[model samples]
Target chain A: MNIPMPDFMPALPEMFLLGMTCVILLLDLFLTERSRVVTYLLAQSTLLGALLLTIMLYDNSRTLTFSDTFVLDPMGSVLKGAIYIATFFVFLYSKGYLRARNMFKGEFYILGLFGVLGMNVLVSAHSLITVYLGLELLSLSMYAMVALQRDSVVASEAAMKYFVLGAMASAMLLYGMSMLYGMTGSLDLTHINQVTAAVGSGQQVVLAFALVFIIVGVAFKLGAVPFHMWLPDVYHGAPTAVTLYLSTAPKLAAFAMMMRLLVDGLGGLHAEWQGILVLLAVASLALGNLVAIAQSNIKRMLAYSAISHIGFLLLGVLSGTAAGYAASMFYAITYVVMTLGGFGMVVLMSRAGFEADRIEDFKGLNERSPWFAFMMLILMFSMTGVPPLLGFWAKLAVIEALLGAGGLTWLAVVAVIFSVVGAFYYLRVVKTMYFDKADAGAAAIESTLELRVMLSANGLAVLALGIYPGTLMALCATALSH
Target chain B: MSFEQILFYVFSAITVLAAGMVITVRNPVHAAMFLVLTFFSSAALWMLLEAEFLAIVLVLVYVGAVMVLFLFVVMMLDLNTTLLREGFARYLPLGILVAVLIAVIMGLAVGQNHFGLAQVAAPAPHAASYSNTQQLGELLYTTYVYPFEIAAVILLVAIVAAIALTLRRRPNTKHQRVDQQVATRREDRVRLVSMTAEERK
Candidate 1:
């Protein structure tokens, strides 16, 4: 199947990202450590630049480039835009944290730009091999990032676990792809879909197994239950800046991969995969929320909370409709905002030589800094799905999609129950901040101008979105319109 | 019965043997080395399948770059073989059980009558033009373009995530900023004076 390259420019966002990354790398080399602010500004500007390019390229028309392996469409554009914006904020949030840690290096900005580039590719990939390439690129960089704090045993251990588990998932994904290739004689997802659509019900059993193996890879990436053992440890062990980036950006990209592969590539096999996803959704909700209540470390708690949100996102996938896809995308976007704010608070509360990761670290936060505490209150409430918060709208969209899908009443109920359980933990953070007494020895919250500005925006955005979610929802719907 | 089949059997045996040694080798460094051997043989098998690009990449990236890093880390760590082996006896029965279960399931799943062991297809007369590498390249760059671009973006995000995780500031450490060092010139600290000795006095 020879596809003539479209006359349209190939990979506009990719070209922009590569060009920006090089410029950032070269420019950072000349910036003094005292002027590390320049690197931060350059990195943020690069992400913003990429985001603008993505928005400008958001046409509904689909074009295949590099001959057919790369695609440009509204869906990919919106996802790329979200990833770039999320990355921009992560860069902003990390600046002060990195500066305080004495490990501020140009490699951080250069590598971050590359990582964002990889995610853009993963979200737009339409072939199995391309998917693997994107996944491996993302995984390899993450492994190195997790181990960046070489002096910390916890970080090293987290990296090791991540590497081993990630490798196993990659192998499973590869084996599944090979099997699919052997059966269909093609690596193109469209071809695979056609082949599977023609197969008999009995033969579909083999396809089902292949799908299970593929979902194992997806489950690992999403940190869904039964494959989520690594999330809490990695989240707790990584430095706050990395944790902020990890919790926000990867979730969105992983959802993009899922939508491309499971929804678009294998939509015909929805019956088989939906069953598996329902089970996973229920399990993730139960395990993630239930386990989180016991965590003393705020990062670990949020990690579990992330797992449960994956469950909510999976509900949208189980719906198996365009609306469901839109809802899932919205859920991912909202979750990114919530996570950034959640981790942004962690960054603000932390000081040099001390990581403020424990739930206890926030005790008396309201008394020590009322404004920051109020900001955290809004974020926590948003995460808990309280009405009039962005998180609430995100949850409402998914639940409505699930209800509309029908035949999933039990799963919907489980989702609600888990939301309650998850809320308990988020609320616990609020209680620690407002109800409890402040610790006399608690570290003073860092008052870097950038941190303050970003944190305020990150937290306020949740409220703003919650109140006027129509715009985000409209964009999501447009992207998933197909 | 043909030479291709003979070569397949040879590489298959080497792959399995090296893979077994990867687990059995007591030293972590040796185990990693054996794993590298396993990867090389696997890549050779991929070449036999006519996937030249994948074969070379598997060898170069996984076997070369990845495994070299693995070896470097394994050698640097102070590993205790005895401590690692202490739980082997306790876990051996469970491991064996799981392994056997996997073997049985795989045997049933891919039995000759199930998945069917069809003979490999004969290569087309124009094998040179229909080379796996060329075909794959054409397909990836053409029909699968969106996915290819998306993959690149994911990789970029991963790079960013890595940098963010490792970059930190420590109050106790003193580090030179590149810009500051570059700003210094020969004339800034070392002034050329007509009578340097008299000036010093």
Candidate 2:
């Protein structure tokens, strides 16, 4: 069969990023140490260009390319835009920290760009092959990024754990995909959807079995409970810069993976996966919140907080409605914004010899710089779901979505109760920053002006969005409406 | 039985028996040998399916290259097989129980058409002119080219990651710097020694 060439217009951003990444990879090798800043500039500019292309290509209609192996739709566009923005900020946040730590190498930026490309591919994935490839690309880059600080044993351990578990998860996910292919006789998600919709009753059990493995992959990627064992260790072990990137952009890829695999491809079997997600959401919410309270390290604390946030995100997903999907997208974006500022604070406070990972490191932070203290305050409050902040609206939207999905009132109540329980840790961070006396040996915030400016905007954006979330909310709803 | 049916049974029985021996063998070397047999028999089974390209690649890759490496490693290592087998007897019951459970489940599933297994029916035979390899190649190049390229990128990332994680410049190492070697004039590595030569004389 002779296949027609796919339209390059929809894949413009990805092709551009892929080509620019190659160019940047070569350019970095030729540049001197002092001129490394140019590489950073080029990387950021590449992301900006991709974002511009994605925005230009935004449309109401879905466009499939590469023999339906890739897709361009409103949801993909929105997610791409978010990933680009998050990754752009991530590069900025990491620059100072990476420079101070003597890891200001081009590889960080290159792997980061690769990771970004992976996210774009994942968001635009139209088939099982692309989904698996995109996820592996994202994961391999992250594993390398985790181990980028080659001399740190902790970083190496984290990287190893992540690599082994991530590789296994990918294998299991592939197994599930193979099973789906065997049953449906197709790899393209659209064709698979058609096949599944008309599948005989006898095959439903086998399909359900395959769905379990796929759900495991999704849960593991999302860092939901039980499968979330790697999240905290990886977060705590990695350099704050890598952690910031890990905590932000790649999440959109996971969310997109869930949306593609579950809603688009397996919508016919919603009843099978819904119960699984519900269990994952509840377990994540209960355990994540309760465990976070006993944590002293802020990175691990945020890790647990991320798990609970995944709970809310999954709640939005398991509702099995358009509104819930939109709500999940909103929650995912909100979680990214909060984490960018949260981990950004850690990066800002860290100096060459000091790692501001411990919660006690924030003692007397208010006295050190009241402005940043307020930024931290806003971030923590937003995360705790306090009113008039982004996290509150995100949680409310998800809870409303859960309630709207009939017969799920109890899950909503569980989410709210955990939110209340989760508030204590966020409050403790604030109280430590404000009430505690400045320790004589406290590390000073080693922030450059750009970081300080971006960090402030990052925090204020959360509050601003919290105050007026309608526009963003509408964007999410409209993205999924098609 | 028909000749084709006899070949299928023969290959499958050898495959399963060798796979079982691969785990049960006391010596690592024997285990490795059994693994090679398993691979060979599995290839035969693939051949029965008319997947000639896959079967040949499996034999060449796994049996030819990988199993050789495995044998080399097994021969080189000074392994304490007795120590390794110390816990095997203790765990045998639990292992057998779990294996039986899985076998039963698979047996039940395969008995029906749920798995599309050999027990239910055979796939339709292809004509002598049909070629699986050619069809697969055409589909890969034409339709699955995007994923194929992505897979290539994944390999590139793996190479980059390996270098990034493991490759380091040891400041004290005596490795030659090609740039310094080529850029060497007279003064960098030599010293004028006329007075020292007279003193030695």
Candidate 3:
């Protein structure tokens, strides 16, 4: 067979970031401790440059490149933009935390930039091979980031656990992809969709098996129940700065992976996969919310909360409609914002020698700094899906999607109940901030003006978006339409 | 049975036996040797199927390079064989049950339905001059070039991750600082004066 040359235009942003990351990696080696800020600046500029390129190459229509392995689409563009903005905030918040812990090094920024590049590729992947490569790249970076603090035994243990579990999940995904390839005789997702759609009963068994494996892999990444064993430990053990990075941007890439695999490639097998997703979603909601209530550590609590939020995300995907997909996209973006704010507070409250991981750290936060406490309140309230916050709209959109799906109304009710149960912990945080008295010797929050400003903007954005989520929702809908 | 069919059975038997020994062996070094044997037998099996490139790669990359690394690691690690084997008997029942279950499932899935020779005929033998490696390389660099590049990137990430995770800077270790060295001045280090000499007496 004659081979066709691959086009690289659609991958311009990825190419740009890849080149920049290498330069930054080498540039960071020569940087002194005081000059590490240069690395941070370069990393940020890399992200900005990528964002600009993505915008310049933006089109509402989908375009396939690199032999149809990579794709450029409106959904990817929107998600890439969201990931960049989230990473920008994460970097800004992490700088002080890193410096305080003597973990201020070029490695964090370089690895982080690499992770962002991975996310960008994941967002644009159109084939199984691309998806696996991007996911591995991201996983490796995350495992390194989690263990960046070499002196911390806990961090090392956490990194080992994350690495092992993540490798297994990647294997499961590859196994599933291999099975799908066997059944369809093609690795291209579109071709697989066509083959799956045309398969007879005999092939359906293999397809079902593949779907089970793929969903297991996806659930592991989402930290859904049963596969969520590693999430809380990694979250609690890593430095607060890494936890902040972990919680915010990676979810967007994971969401993109789900969309590409489930909605784009395996849409033909929806009837089968949706059943599996429904079970996972309900289990995640029940387990995530219930377990989170028992956690006294804020990081662990948010880890469980991330699990439950993933349930909500799956609820949107299981709706099996364009509108449902759009709603999930919207929820994913909003959840990232909420994550930045929630973990930003953890980073803010932490000092050089003190870790603000305990639930009690937020006691009388209002008494300390009313402005930030209110921001914290907004984040917690939004997470609990309280009214007039962006989190509310996010949940409402998913619930609306489920209701629109007709038969899934009962699942919606179960989700709402779990969210209500989930609300208790978040409100307890709010109560601690507002009602409890601050300890006389509690360390004061040492924060930069940039963090305070960005965090406030992040917090208020939730409230602002909640009150009026029209534009963003419309954008999500538009991205999903084509 | 034909001579070729008898040879096939021999290679298959060796591959299976060696693979079984890989997991069941007590000594880590023995396990590594068993794995190498398994890889060689599998390469022979692949050669029987006319997949010359894959057979050579299995021997060259896996048995030659990867197995050597495994053997080195096994030697370097101070592992207690008795301690490692302590819990094996206790877990044997559960392991056997799962293994049997998997065997039965495979029997039904691949054995009964998919593996019928009538369903999948053996390929005709290639001409003696046919170079599987050339065709494989052409496909890898041309048609599958996207995946090829991606695989390269994954390896790059692996290198970065391995180094970043394992490399540590010990705070107590003495290392020259270029900036400190460059900024050093004679006055800051020496501090000599006539009054100081009188005070010393």
Query: Considering every candidate listed, which one attains the maximal TM-score?
Result: 3
The sequence of per-residue lDDT tens digits that candidate 2 reaches over residues A342-416 is 999999989888898999999999999999999999999999999999999999999999999999999999999
- Interface DockQ of each model: 0.26, 0.61, 0.41
TM-score for model 1? 0.86
| Candidate 1 Cα outliers beyond 4 Å, as residue runs | A1-10, B2-7, B27-79, B111-201
Each candidate's interface RMSD: 4.9, 1.5, 2.1
**Chain B TM, every candidate:** 0.80, 0.73, 0.81
What would the per-residue lDDT of candidate 1 be over residues A309-390, giving only the tens digit for each residue? 9999999988998888899999999999999999989888888888889999999998889989999999999988999999
Candidates sorted on lDDT, descending:
2, 3, 1
Q: Tell me how candidate 2 scores on lDDT.
A: 0.92
The better candidate by lDDT, 2 or 3, is 2
Give the alpha carbon lDDT tens digit for every residue of B1-201 in model 2: 999989999999999999999988888999999999999999999999899999999999999999999999999999998888798889999999998986675565444667655423668989999988998898788888899888988888888888888788789978878998999999988997675335544
User: Which residue ranges in model 3 land beyond 4 Å of their true spot?
Assistant: A1-4, B1-8, B82-99, B115-125, B169-201
Query: Candidate 3: which docking quality band?
Result: acceptable
User: Candidate 1: global Cα-lDDT?
Assistant: 0.83
Candidate 1 lDDT over B18-130, as tens digits, reads 89999898889889988988998899898887888899999999987999899888889988899889989999999999999867766654556346655235554445766
As for DockQ, the candidate ahead, 2 or 3, is 2
Measured with C-alpha atoms, the lDDT of residue B72 in candidate 3 is 94
